[model samples]
Target chain A: MSGFFKSSIGRKYAMALSAFFLMFFLLQHFAINILSVFSPDAFNEASHFMGTFWAVQYVLQPVLIFGVMYHFIMGFILEIKNRNARVAKYAKNNGAANSSWMSRNMIYSGLAILAFLVLHFIDFWLPEISTKYIQGDMSGLLADSEGFRYYEELTHKFVNPLRVGAYVIAFVFLSLHLTHGFSSAFQSSGVSSMRKEKLQIFGKVYAIAIPLGFIAIALFHHFNH
Target chain B: MNLTLKIWRQIDANDKGKMVDYKVTEISEHMSFLEMMDVLNEQLVNTGEEPVAFDHDCREGICGMCSMYINGEAHGPDRGVTTCQLHMRMFKDGDTITIEPFRAKAFPVIKDLVVDRSAFDRIQHAGGYISVNTSGNTQDANATLISKHAADEAMDAATCIGCGACVASCKNASAMLFVGAKVSQYALLPQGQVEAADRVKNMVAQMDLEGFGNCTNTGACEIECPKGISLENIARMNRELLKANV
Candidate 1:
């Protein structure tokens, strides 16, 4: 394990595996969030289903959280190690502008995504899980007796131009982050082939389309309200 | 033609280098970039000042020894040409060109524009060779019929002179193009396939050990490369690396 961590192949595997894990969450999260676009009640139903699933809430939730933490920590540690190695090897300024701009700014973009994650959890997860389910607060947004207020809060937040604008901005940053991360995740995962070329095109489309969808929903709610 | 040079001057590896200005007059346009530098050195020698030190041999661009970062470019402004192939005509009479050595932790400065590129040699030594034993040239040259396309591609990959320009031109100082070319040259041919897995694994391991950064596939290395080595080679190496691991 130590030798694997120290090797290039090891690092690539770690990057790929972590990215794959994160991507799983991304797909599920997007699926859940897309519900809000169809109907506020539909999103509430999905949230209630998630909250009521004892197996998911007890077993899968902890595992998913572990996966997220592992992915984030490993990605950051490997990036730092790779950076230090590069700095020590090249002490001059000759090769500063030849690579992709996204590669150079991965860490910064990652931090931005991380910051957005915190705000996202506060806006969505905390209220849905803590305020409604845990604390049993049946207020304006959490008025549903079924113990699910995700859609109400989401619609209410999107109805506010400022909140909707923040979501749009965050999604834009997420798209930018995905532009590089999508292809890079594949490469680091040791999946570089003609398959990757197809995947790259798909990755680019997904990176753009998903974020745009989220933005569209936000704008729709803001305008309709 | 007269030209002003802002050359980097460092006493040793420990010294902090700075751009020192020098003026050279009566330069010929036909002279190669290095020959122009030679003229400047001759002038400095006559004036009892130390000559600007740089690496060059063969002066034919094939040797890969003429490494220079000129005016924010590896091997000057000429595309698909080494510094030795770059002529004085590329610059004007009043051009203030900044000349510096390749900068990377793997490539340390030796003097003015000279650097130690032995790290590349070390990486190559690590696993860049096929372990076939030569028994007095027993095999005929025509014994193996490589396809025309494969032969051409292999040769194209083999065209890398190991100049360190890839590292010099990369933003992260990544040696992906250089290492990729080396790996591709071997991996494409049957002669190199016997040790293909080990070769890629070892070479990539060595490349990381030498402290080169990751390949971002930005296409800059391909553009700045004097030989026009493709980024496809890096992709090929990535494919090979995946195969080796799995």
Candidate 2:
């Protein structure tokens, strides 16, 4: 087990597994968030279930926290190791011709995503935690009217142009990160094959589509009357 | 033609290398990249200076012995050819060609233009070959009919000469292509079925133990490989490793 963590492929396996978890989390989060745009009642009900469920709070949340930390930390460690792997760089490196820009610059895009996570946690996760644990004022968090707190808080957050711009830009970076990372995770996990082009196509579509959907939600909220 | 050569020079493994410039003139276009270096070495020998050291044998490009990172590309700029097969016509008369050894943490510089590639040998020893009953009458591998596509893929993978070009060209200095090709060569063939699980696991373990970096799937290895080994080999290895893990 110790030897597995030290191995390069093993480290990559961890990354692939964690990334898969995060990808599923992204899809789930997207679904819930997208619901708020149309039906706040459904959104509130789902959010209530997600928020109040003891198994989700205790079990899955901890797993997600660990997964996020593990994925992000390992990414940085791999980046540093990769840098040290090449002690001396080429005097003239034509990396563009050899591979995709996103593939080579994974660390940069990853750092950007990490930065975005901080703002994300502060905006959403932190407030939910405060409402649940710190203040212990659950009723203060509810807005069951046509003016749903679920919709209201999200729309209010997007009303700030800078914040909306940041969200849009972060999602753009997310797309870039996933452009290489999506297919790459499958490649690392051995889910990809030579005979089938499904993974690659699915990867590109997901990379583009998911981020675009997130951007749409952000924009839709910002423009909400 | 006159050319300015910027070659890496170092006395030993511990010593730091610096690019030393030299002039080689009146070169023929038909001369190979190594022959051009030989011409420069002859000039240095005629003078009172120490000649440059480089690795080369089987100058026809089969041995994978001729390793050089020339002008940023592994085995020079010519596609699908090792340093031994690269001709002078690829360069202009006044070209300033910068030559350096392959740089990877796993491949420490032994001297000028030569690094230790024993890591690859160790990896190969780990699980690169199959255990056959050579002591007794063995089943001839040729007796069985393999699909042409599989055979061709195996042939393509078997073409890897262990040149370390993949490591040199990769940003992360990953040896995935080298190990991938070796693993794929056997994985695609029927004879390699018995120890397939152990082979994948052992080779990958050895590869990681060799201080090599992880594959980012950059495809640099295939682009710069002298033999044009396909990236599908790496994919096959990944599949095999997954199967092994399962």
The candidate that wins on lDDT is 2
lDDT of candidate 2 over A31-126, digit per residue (tens): 999997888778877887788788998999999999999999999898888878878776666677678899888888888889899999999889
Q: lDDT, candidate 2, residue B14?
A: 91
Model 1 reproduces a share of the real contacts of: 0.33
Candidate 1 achieves a global lDDT of: 0.78
- What DockQ does each candidate score versus the true complex, computed on alpha carbons? 0.32, 0.52
Tell me which residue pairs clash in candidate 1: A89-B104, A89-B105, A89-B106, A90-B104, A90-B105
Give candidate 2 misplaced runs (Cα > 4 Å). A1-6, A39-42, A139-147, B135-138
TM-score of 2: 0.92
Residue A70 error, candidate 1, Å: 4.4
Error of 2 at A53 (Å): 3.8
Q: Assess candidate 1 and give its TM-score to the true structure.
A: 0.87
| Model 1 misplaced regions, further than 4 Å | A1-5, A20-24, A54-71, A86-97, A131-141, A144-148, A159-162, A189-197, B26-29
